[model samples]
Target: MASSNNQQPSPNTHHNPLFDEFRWVIQIRHSLEEDHDDDIGIPVSIFNVPKPLQLSKPEAYVPQLIALGPYHHWRPELYEMERYKLAAARRTQKHFHSIKLPQLVEQFTKLEHKIRAHYHRYLDFSGETLSWMMAVDASFLREFLQVYAVEEEEEGKALRRLSSRMSHLVDYTGRKSAHNVILRDIMMLENQLPLFLLRKIMELQCSSTDAADEKLAKMVTSLLKELSPFKLMENFPCIDVTQHAHLLELLYCVIVPQSDEQTEDNEIEEQNDDAGAPKEGRQSYGNSGHVKQLFNSVWNVGSTLNGAPVRFIRGIIVSRPVKFVVQLPWKILTGLPGFSILKQPVEYVFSLQGGQENTKVSNPLDASVSRPPLVEEIMIPSVTELISSGVKFSPTNGDLTTIAFDVKTVTFHLPTVSLDVNSDVILRNLVAYEASAAMGPLVFTRYTELMNGIIDTEEDVRLLRERGVVLNRMKSDAQVAKLWNGMSRSVRLTRVPFLDKAIEDANKYHDGRWRVKTGRFMKRYVFGSWQVLTFVAAILLLLLTGLQAFCSVYTCSRWFGGVMNNVQKQN
Candidate 1:
């Protein structure tokens, strides 16, 4: 797929419709070289689920690769993939042909909301979801639901309704071709035996009556049929707490949900925006082909104390939710100003307006001329810090190791945003530079540091040598147009060689152009189904017929009158 024709996408263009395309290409390519073992098993270790490496198809994962230009070169195998994409695109064009742009946006919004909950572990689910927030391949479950299922479609007004395409994925996950070899058997070949075997096993575990809900039952059923839960019991022991727990266990169950409720109350908190923190724009499609694009609404962040203003990106979400859970991105929130449980107040300084009196203000870091610019430091107080500060803990090292306090949770109110585009459009979703490489120029360095972590001045000697390197990377073009909204004041620039304003002008036209198409089929036309085009033609014909009749009648009346007048004159 990496052939010239299927070029790798720019890291930021994650709006990709197919995140799993890359992985599928890899698997298919490997299949070419390796022998297909008909006996090879699908790995179905539910407790040991794999980590997600890529986004899935449908609306599940966005492609982060930025659009460059026409791609060169193509692998012969990629032709097959291209065909699949074409079919999908054609399907979308047809379904959306009858729906207006606004209605299309609303449909997408509903789908996004339904899946957003699934992206996270249910807040009601056991605490296990939180621990795997960053680690597990939650996409395993997502793909298991989406890939095998057929997408619903209604093209060209042909009234056909099929079951959800997602069900196939769910069904595939539960297939059990081999008794002991669960997933290994199912993934081996395209046979129905594996599916049959898995279903039998689930039937043994929980009766239909025992299921909590239809969905919960399906989840259990899929797991049972695919993995051979009955066979796996021989090698793997399952601890059924419901069977072994005593009175204390029953008491704990009653207390746990209440404790969960209390924890949630304390966990989520909303912080008002800081006066100094930069604000970004949001984009959404609106009525009549209009777009509401918010731009340049936040703060004035610059380099050196008052250096020229700079451009910076915020962050983008990587996952959508399912069920009732939502996993907010940590990278986006890192730069946002809030109560960092780990941060300490470095110092406060007063901004002098016209006063000579020394004043104390909470600026977080002092920026006055008298004091050296406050080295912006992010203080992280570990459990050790808490203990050192005499918060009272006396356990030995190994005894206290169970506490995973390295992660500090901060909750804030997230604004209501639609599903298509995110609130922070400037924050491109992909990272091209390797985290191992040295940091970039000044403005970018600070921006990255805000998302990552502070630089260590003591250990790193390269910090002193990067001033010129950073300055040389400044953007030269008028990409500033990408920043401000439609209301900004104008500026004049002398056009130059090679790089002209023509490109910008053409881009402006393309970006602003709008085209609309619509179609509808009414149940019955009281006007009697003379198609609109045919009706208009009939009206034109009727008008011509009336004009002809009027001319004939006028000619006869004048001829008769002249004849009578001649007879009277003769008499």
Candidate 2:
């Protein structure tokens, strides 16, 4: 009986799903251990664009024509580019006599775990699948980027002419072409290939590692120069390619190079002092203390004489009693029928002066204690507003770090930027990459935000364009304005102290103008209290009307005359 019971089939004889999961985990652990020694400390550079940013401009972050990495490699829409990618791989293999496509794939497979670590998201594909995808994508990318290579080698020229299928895609003849779309795709954050893979592929074709790296650098520089909106300098800083995770990162390093250890605040202070104040030596003389005191006394006397009348008039105008008298008529008119329509426009004009009140005190300590905490937000006016406030705009040949405000000239110096159809995609992707990487300071992102703040409408764009600060290749000023305005949605609020200082100086210069101050005073004291003033005016009008009615009905003057006569007789 016991033998018969043992012979029965066990209930757990079939395969258990848990065992399969356990084996998979073990395999992954082993792979990780094997590659742990070879880890290059590459962070997850490739990221799915954050949902907020993606929702704002999905086209900027997602691949439109082709997908390079495994993130979007499986999308059916991008799969159509697979055949061309394979062709590129085939042509790339032909360049190297010693290595075949399968050999490249095998090399990539060996480094699969290391490659996977570069991506933030988990790749669901097997090791072999990821290797093949990377190899093909790297080959395609290398072939495409060669079109923009600064120095065209025999291999690049031959490859360009040999592949008829790739000719249309690499043709740089027209402004509008499939080539441009592919260029945009490659710049997308999700559609990036590992730079190491590209270097490996290039190394296979070149004579030596040094030759491969040289060609790769030239190719990347040329690509950046072509795609970057800002002009690249003749002696652009040389960057180590291996340190960067991908092409976008390499491009960012070139554009917003890591700043020095010197803090931005200190640099700004130095610039402000240099631009605004006279040199220290000019104010000093070898034994001239008495002469200095005499000069200062004379200067103070002359200044007082020159400014006394102007200050007296300003004081009278800004005085509360005078403001009330000036506003009384307008307030009364506003309450009348058909005059109510002017109220909103009047209020709006006045609202602009809300923050211009004088808060300074005689005591510095009291002022400091009572002063509001400084807000980190940047609140500079628009370009048109700045220009209207007597601030001038000037285009500069320098980079982003060169932006400055010339206090003497009252000029806002900005780096010249060329705008075209591709500008939007390039700028958006750069900002997206910066946001994702969490790099030290988002210099480029802050630059875009600065532009967005300054350009509020087509008028601002036109002004910038006319000033040569903006080179608009787009069809209309409206489009350029729209492009910049749309970008403000995805950017995080950040304070780049240097840029902020430039803005601060410009605002101070603008606000210091007499016209601006007067306008703010009018808005704050006169127009800002329209409602209360209107109510008072209405009540006064009612009391006057009653007085007139009483006088018309009775002889009020005769009644007061008789009362005065009676009082005089009693006295």
Candidate 3:
């Protein structure tokens, strides 16, 4: 009894593994419940970069020049940008008459809870720290946009000072510019300020007038325009800007707008739908249909499925002419109405049959009908193979809406993409955003995937360069190929049927067995050298001549023997 009182009880008394595990399970469940209770609202748009994708290419997803949001706000590498942020904050204060920087900080401080709810990951900063970060970022962004918004005369002094400050970031002989890197960083998916702050800041800065809304729109549009490679900003359709969540969403809307007409059409189609089956014009191109389309492309080869000989057309006329010599002539040509008329054919040819058309045709090549569901896999010929197969590649007018593939013409139209130092950064962020967003357009992702499949080697890059499809500003073609191939490391593709169908068609045309066999035979034994073809022709001619001579000799011998035998018998 004394031993039982003084000594420890049996080791199994309180050391049950099952009980320990059960307690752990309860603790985990309680923690998860606490986390769920802490979450106040639904986070739909902005998201942290998935671990797999981030791990694959961390540098591309992470910002280099600046950190605009809380995700990278505390990183040691981004400390250099903090001074610039402070400078931007000081500049931003001058823009506001009523609200000073401290007042603005106070305003964001009051809305700390609301702002924190937007981020997907748990931010580690306290409320005060979080608000301060938001205030600083918001102020810098406004000033940055304002600098680009105002005219040269209005912002000349500011621009010069800004340039002076930024000059240290880039060397004079360097391939990249500081401004481009900043633009790329700002466009990153995770490094975005909340749209509410942008609007509120704009409101505080605007005059008390109805033009305030238009003023805000114009400012945002101009800022986005200066950053984009495509200058079609002016043509962007009016959208409810209030629906946008951030700069990335605004940029996306400007690029791939869901027009009111399209919305009405979708509604009408939905109303008319009878069961789960799609209507005549809206049929989904399932696996079977995709295969048939592929077969058709291969079967037709250089022609359409209906046996019509297709005409090849260049999408954009590439001219890096001797500028010193041709500039004067080009300027003169530009002055003429006839020259403008000639230019219209190339610029507006694809747009005439763009997605706005109303007709519903069964043919995938017809632009009047909705495009078929893209193939399950993305496939296209390498640049070298496409050139060898007689397919032409030309640049588009920097608008992705112009991306089209005409199997009838055996031509592929792509945007005149400038492959600068920031191209990879800009493209990858856009892809990451698309992957994260609930319904982000997959246009950019599909384009990169298509480019990756086609640019497998340096030869492919050379061919693309020659065709003016890729204006590679980088050091080498291998670098260009590597940039694209690495972009799709962990990307998940959705069904963008038109893009899929186009790529599949291109692959089918290039990889068709019959076409491949014929090309090989011509390139190897016959077209290997002119001498080989001449030798084969000579051998065939000699053989034919020898056979004719042999037949003639045999006939003469038989006739002579028969005549001799008849004469002898008669005697």
Q: Pick the candidate with the highest TM-score.
A: 2
Q: In candidate 3, how many Å is residue 44 off?
A: 3.2
Q: Candidate 1: where are CA atoms >4 Å away?
A: 1-201, 204-262, 272-571
Predicted candidate 1 versus true structure: per-residue lDDT over 365-404, tens digit per residue: 1222112111222222222222223222121111111112
- Backbone collision count in every prediction? 42, 0, 2
Candidate 1 vs 2: which has more lDDT: 2
Expressed as tens digits, the lDDT of each residue in 344-459 for candidate 2 is 44443322232233342132212212222122223468999899998899988767887989999999999889887788888888888888885455678778778988888999
* Per-prediction TM-score: 0.16, 0.71, 0.60
| Clash count, candidate 3 | 2
Candidate 3: 10-residue stretch with minimal lDDT: 307-316
- Models ranked on lDDT: 2, 3, 1
When superposed on Cα atoms, how far off is each prediction in RMSD?
37.0, 13.5, 19.0
Indicate the worst ten consecutive residues by lDDT in candidate 1: 345-354
Evaluated at residue 308, the lDDT of candidate 1 is 14
lDDT of each: 0.24, 0.72, 0.61
Model 3 Cα lDDT, one tens digit per residue, 152-182: 5765555465645655553222334776677
